[model samples]
Target: MTRRVFLSIMTAAGVSLLAAMLLILGMLQSAYTQRYRQQLRDEAAYAAAGLETGGTAFLAALPAGSGRITLIGADGTVLYDSIGTQDMENHSGRQEVQQALASGTGESSRYSATMGERTYNYALRLEDGRVLRVSAADFTLPEVLRSLAKPLLLIAVIVVLLSLFLALKLTRSIVRPINQLDPEHPDKAEIYPELSPLLDRLSSQSGQIDEQIRELRRKQQEFAAITENMQEGFLILDRDTNLLSYNTSALRLLGADDAVLGQSVLGLNSGSSFRDAVERSIAGEHYQRTMHHDGRYYQLIANPVHQEDGIIGAVLIILDVTEKDQRENQRREFTANVSHELKTPLTSISGFAEIIMSGLARPEDITHFATNIYAEAQRLITLVGDIIKLSQMDENSIPVEKEPVDLREIADFACERLSQAAAKKHITMAVHGSRETVSGVHQILEEMVLNLCDNAIKYNVEGGRVDITVSRDPRGAVFLSVADTGIGIPQSDRERVFERFYRVDKSHSKEIGGTGLGLSIVKHGAAYHGATLSLESELDKGTVITMTF
Candidate 1:
């Protein structure tokens, strides 16, 4: 800033000095040229008078001076020459001499080739048919300019030096007050009186700018806070596909660190498809994709941020849709299983009815066919009922009534309801525990206990023991555990043991004569009663399902 100010001052001074020098030189040249011409005229008139009065004796007697006196005959012959170069050139034929012959007096200026100098000439026609011309070597405009060069150069040097000195002083003087001004507290700074208005405006504008910056920062912080707390991953990218900002969720979802910021998305991971989608979004295309990565499912949505010119960046939102995807898969499987389950029973009933209608079976075999048809119909009814219950549980549409019920009594009732099945399976089942009270809907609790006991009997080994224990633990919660010496679930299958229509032994499932929804119902019912269900099972050892109320 200081250098700029100094240079500006020096430039102005130099230009002004140049203009003044040109003007003075022009005026001086004109005045000096005119004065020299006038002198030449006066000398010529005086000499002409002398020659007329004393003839050639006056010219011969005169001392030699800087002026040249030339006498030319009317017939273009040089009569006498004082400067001595008139030997070859006739003075009567000169422009001034010819003019003088025609009009009695003439003056002109020209350069002499022999003398190599310029001269001013004044010719006056004499009464004796001759011309008396006075000539003087005079400085031409070029010579005059040459004479002034030294002084002008000295003046220019002085001007530049003085301009430099003054420019420094002036620049510092003007800038000091402005530099000393405290922009943050402009009211307290001493400044020029003329700048008071500007200072006031500066102070006002400073406050406004500060406020706007603070507001912008505060808004940015608020946005950061909101995004950082979001469950879905949120990210912003620049037009170059570099990461501008990303939330904590985004970092976790992408398995990336904060170092990924300001880097291209491709550098963060091997998800080329994700990077491609981001590039497409930056090109003003909206993109969406569902990807399974790192044991979870995510839905990516990219939207371009467009301005008047074009897309400037993009906003990417990663949705953790793991649960949704799982639900969708479960629904598909349920549909397939429902079709298969219904088909099996319907086919049996259809085959038996066709056999009866065709009369292909003997009369004795008719009873057996009818019985099998009735059994198949009952199994179909059970499957339908289980499906309806599962749907209701999924919809959370069950009505609830909170009432205190004894866990021991529910276990007893469940065992009695499945006593025949237990007997048929030859499984020993008994309830042995202190009575514990729990507050929930009686129907839900009963259903939960019944399912657990039925599962214990259905999957138990022949003559295996089924124990129902209803008691309270140290936590003061009612605990009901149904432990069976059954074909235990495998470690891998334990996680999915409660899913609808999932049977561990599919080939023997029909022989077992049980719907695969027993444990699924138990899970839902226990959840409805606000009970925690835990399963401890081992292959070929035993399984225990405990419900803590």
Candidate 2:
């Protein structure tokens, strides 16, 4: 701005100065020409007077430096020429001579091409009927200016320098106040009246901008709070699939680091389904897919972000559906297992009853068939009861209030109830450790302990021992452990033992005459009591299951 203003002022000054110089020069040229012409007339008249008195001798007496002089006869023949050049042109056709002949005196000027000068001629009609002429030659206007070129150039340089100095001062004065104005407080600046309106506008705009910035920051904070607290992974991407914004859950779910920001979404997970979902969303289509990442299933829901101009980007939501998927699979497996387990008992009962009803067996066979039927019916009832208990736990519909219960009492009760089974298996059962009280439903704890003891006796070797320990660990946590000398679980089947209907020895599960939900019940009851369950087992050695509350 300053440079433009300075240049403008300099240009105006230069133009004005140039015009003034040209005007003055033109006026001086006109005035000088007029004055020079008058002198020529005076010289011509004086020469004519001298010629009238002194005749040709007067011309001879004139100084050589005098201007050109000519005497012409009335017949228009050159009588005397001061320069004395031979064969001089006749003056008959000369305008000044013709005019002097007609009148008393005449003046004219012409350009001499050879000399490049303007020649002024003044003619006087002598009383002797002859013409006396005096002529003077001077450089033309162009020649005069050329001769004064150095001085004019010096003057122009001086003017330009002065103009530049003044222009600089003016530009500084004009621009300084503007530069001094505070953008944050434009209204407080003391400046030109013409700039007051501009300052007011600046103040207004600044206020508006500040308010807008604050609003944006507030909204950004709100967005951050919402996203940071989200459990599901959330991501925002540009049209090019570059990550723009993301939540912590997204980083964890995708196994990505913070460095993934501003990088392509594929950098986080380039799996086919993940890439497909993102690409489809970027193409303005909504897409969803189940993507398996890090051995966990994730539901990727990609939505195109739309505005008036069309789809500009995309939003990706990744939900950790691994638990849901596992539950679904469990439900299916449990349904099939329950059907097979129930059908087996009911089929055995039905077959035995049919044999008695059909009279296929005699009176001796009838009692035996009845005993088998009763046993199968009992097994069915137990299986149904276990299923109901598990269902109740699953739905959290157990209608029992919690109370402080002694772990030793529960362990002793379990040992008593399963004593007959232990006797039949020739397995020794014992409870050790002091009383450890925990807050729990009494019935649930008893059932959990019963299941643990029952499994220990049922799966033990003859003359093997089952030890139930009820005590407090060093951490003051109530610990209950059921260790047995039984056919230990294989390494492969150890982790699955706590799942419903999962058995370490599936081949002997039917002959074992027990529902497969024993450990599962223990697991659920432990979870309900806020306890941690751990297992240690070695094939052909023994197994130990511990619960800490």
Against the unseen true structure, what C-alpha lDDT does each candidate score? 0.85, 0.87
Cα lDDT for residue 507, candidate 2: 86
The sequence of per-residue lDDT tens digits that candidate 1 reaches over residues 1-549 is 657766786788789987887787788878987887888888778788888888877887778764878888898787887756435576656889889999999878899775578888889998887888888887566776688899878987887787778778887887899989998888888888988998999999999999999999999999999998899998888899888888889878888775467888666657866777788899999899987779988898999998898888999999999999898999999889889989999999999999999989999999999999999999999889888877777677877758889889988998889889889878888999998888887877787788888878878999898999988879798889999998899988888989988888888887776778888988887777678989999877789999988
- For model 2, the superposed segments whose C-alpha errors exceed 4 Å read 1-3, 83-95, 112-116, 138-144, 161-203, 221-241, 247-251, 254-262, 267-287, 302-316, 356-367, 473-476
Off by over 4 Å in 1: 1-159, 180-188, 257-259, 279-286, 303-306, 309-311, 347-377, 423-426, 430-437, 471-478
Q: Provide the clashing-pair count of each candidate structure.
A: 0, 0
**Per-residue lDDT value at 427 in model 1:** 85
Error of 1 at 514 (Å): 1.7
What is the TM-score of each predicted model, taking all chains together?
Answer: 0.70, 0.86
By summed lDDT, which 10 consecutive residues of candidate 1 come out lowest?
83-92
How many Å off is the CA of 532 in candidate 2? 1.9
lDDT of 2 by residue, 380-469 (tens): 989999999988888888999889999999898888888888898788889999999999999988999888888888778988999999
